[model samples]
Target: MKHIFKNGIIGLACLFSFNAMAENYTIGTGSQSGTYYPLGGILAKIWSENIEDFDMRAEVTAASVENTIKVSSNKQLAGIAMGNVVLQAHEGIKPFPRKMDVSVLFALYPNVVQFIVPADSDIKSIKDLKGKRISLGAPGSGTRVSATNILASLGITDKDIDAQSLNYTATTNAISAGQIDAGVIVGSVGVGAITELAFTHKIRILSFTADELKKVSEDNASYQSIEVPAESYKNVSAFNAPAVWNILIVNKNMDTDLAYQMTKVAFENMSKINQVISVTKFTTLENMNKLNGIDLHPGSLKYLKEQM
Candidate 1:
């Protein structure tokens, strides 16, 4: 079945995998200033350079959930998404209205949930969000989806706060302008936006309380406990949070040989990719193979098996 497409052309193939004669493609990545965009930019550059007949580029998007939607609709040949979101899309669960016919290309990185605030903001725990001004995330973005669920698990809701839906850049700017008390950003451990924010203003990354965390993990098994080390960004201290795996996804209809070659190229160009996607530096084929949110495309699985 075809899935939703956000401002892109949806391919005609929806019910089954099919090959296309054309080789041009676009990767739907996250915000221009976020981790996914840079990662996609590097990957697009690599694929364009290495694969003959490959005409590829990356576009800034709302990220994860939206990417999954677009890829499922064949609006994109491939995209990146959070593990939980891939599962949700494939299963036709909440945050998705219908099952998406999609497959995983490979697992990539993790996006940790970071609740940011000014250094002097009194809000410390998830509970403190009540009666506060907060920027959840852009209305349709993955950051908002995760942030909303995480807060709901701790008995907090939009009604409890002066909520505004804004993207990372706007949210961070709001915090700096003293317009919002806090903002929730799910990104790489040391996302560029956070790094830049810290360079000028004093900020704090909040940690969930034990009880809040217990509730969160119990409710959403997809979220794994993680600790962001001290000083990951300027003056941002160590803090605990939940993280979700990021996966590369593609339409199951992708040319099998093309998928295999693309998978191989990704591994071969890991070093260059690492410069833009720092989290990949810590991942490996072994750990990447351990991923379990969505079904792997047969083409991708075939390549992975050969490597094993």
Candidate 2:
């Protein structure tokens, strides 16, 4: 009986020790309805499963800008953000109060800047959006920054349009309800909000003209030219759009070993992650260099060197 009691106590102690050793981390993501949330969840799960005693959770945030802010402040261990947004933060550009200390883990995929309106609407081009009500995306979101910059590039300022700050879902809802003439969303090609909005309302994604694309890209080096396929959305034609890479970011001060382990595990399980999130198909070693000037975390750098 004494032996049995001693063994049971030993088992309990072991369990307690395991629990005590577990470390929890969080990755900031966008709205629950957006791509970042699910993608972040999948990544957190992957890292947690592969790294014993590690628990990573995805926290809902206002998307890129907020993610960068949180990650820099150490409110989040890491975050998913657009390349431009991270660049802005790193450089202490507008919206960011000061230079944020963050480093890139890797580039995930290109998030297209989409401008949507009803198919039959007279707003044929971005120029037509002048004097019209438009949603620039949620406050503090990278979508807003992209929209604002694009508009500024075209000489369309806040004075030129009635701007509304709404999130991905809200922007779609507002447009569907006729509350806004057009809405801007920066996300994966077939973002859930835009996809769901298409089922109930015939919509068109406005393509950027060559000159306009050049202007936007020139205005922001982080912006890239990408073509959205016709089949990406219902009844929407293939469109030329400005895109920015979506990157995984961490604080520069993150433990070197922890960052290395996380980066290594993520790359090793790319196939598994891609199976769950198609956009992650871009999360390859080759794409890691597409961080658009953001410094790579030392841990991730170490892992990448090993791959070479």
Candidate 3:
């Protein structure tokens, strides 16, 4: 970080004394098959190609909630997580033990709540899931938390269905083998897990009623209504569902100059990142830096202000 800030600023040398070695870093992303991993790969490649000596890599783990925890605990490591999970991490909500010192850089995309079943199945609506086996997403993931809340809003509880905590691939396999009735996935508009399922088995996406959507909105401010495009996947058509915003987050204690540099480099080459994952379309200069209830990193804030 020697050249991160121009010389002659007061206390600059003292500040650099502690933040001197800015070498290898990592971003805690989600599963390799999910968007976060690829998104991280794109950013890492861009930074290594465009910037100097910034050796970065993507670490696959649980998507939102785990990413938030890792970012809060480690200063050098950043994360890609859901907006609501980031908020929960910073505020020390139900899932978090205590308030975490975290901040956001830019917004990602939305995690569309998907309830998928075999195309020919008779499970018509959320109501039909009673006494059926369903995967609610792997434990400690944002999908699991969102799945539970979404079901609660729809008047479905744990007792109403046979709950299974499984990841996307596991859920997909179970549904394919007829071991489960349906699988709940929370990802972008055309998540790979559901799309992959369409290859071997006919898939049907369930739509949330307008009233159900309203109830979800009232219960969770982070989620929004969305429509999956028609024929986005094989043997599957369009459907409406609720979605949650995903964001790139970092520890507030991270080096401000490094954070600023990362933010600037990312926006300068947003197209490269977007090419790898189309969901980045939701991230924009107009509002990328804005988060729900958490603070934005001071360096990221500076970069956004200057871009204007």
Best by lDDT: 2
Candidate 2 on 243-262: residue-level lDDT in tens? 99999998777767777888
lDDT of 3 by residue, 148-218 (tens): 98898888999999999998889899999999999998888767877777877888989888898999989
Give each model a TM-score. Answer: 0.91, 0.93, 0.91
lDDT of 3 at 94: 64
Q: Give the TM-score of candidate 1.
A: 0.91
Per-residue accuracy of model 1 over 55-133 as CA lDDT, tens digit each: 6899888888789888878778789887777887888987899988778888887789999999998988778889999
Question: Cα lDDT of model 1 overall?
Answer: 0.82
Report residue 260 deviation for candidate 1 (angstroms). 1.2
Candidates ranked by lDDT, best first?
2, 1, 3
TM-score pick, better of 1 and 2: 2
Each candidate's number of clashing pairs is 0, 0, 0
Alpha carbon RMSD to native, model 3: 4.2
Q: Which stretches of candidate 2 lie over 4 Å from their true place?
A: 1-21
Q: Mark the regions of model 1 whose C-alpha exceeds 4 Å error after superposition.
A: 1-22
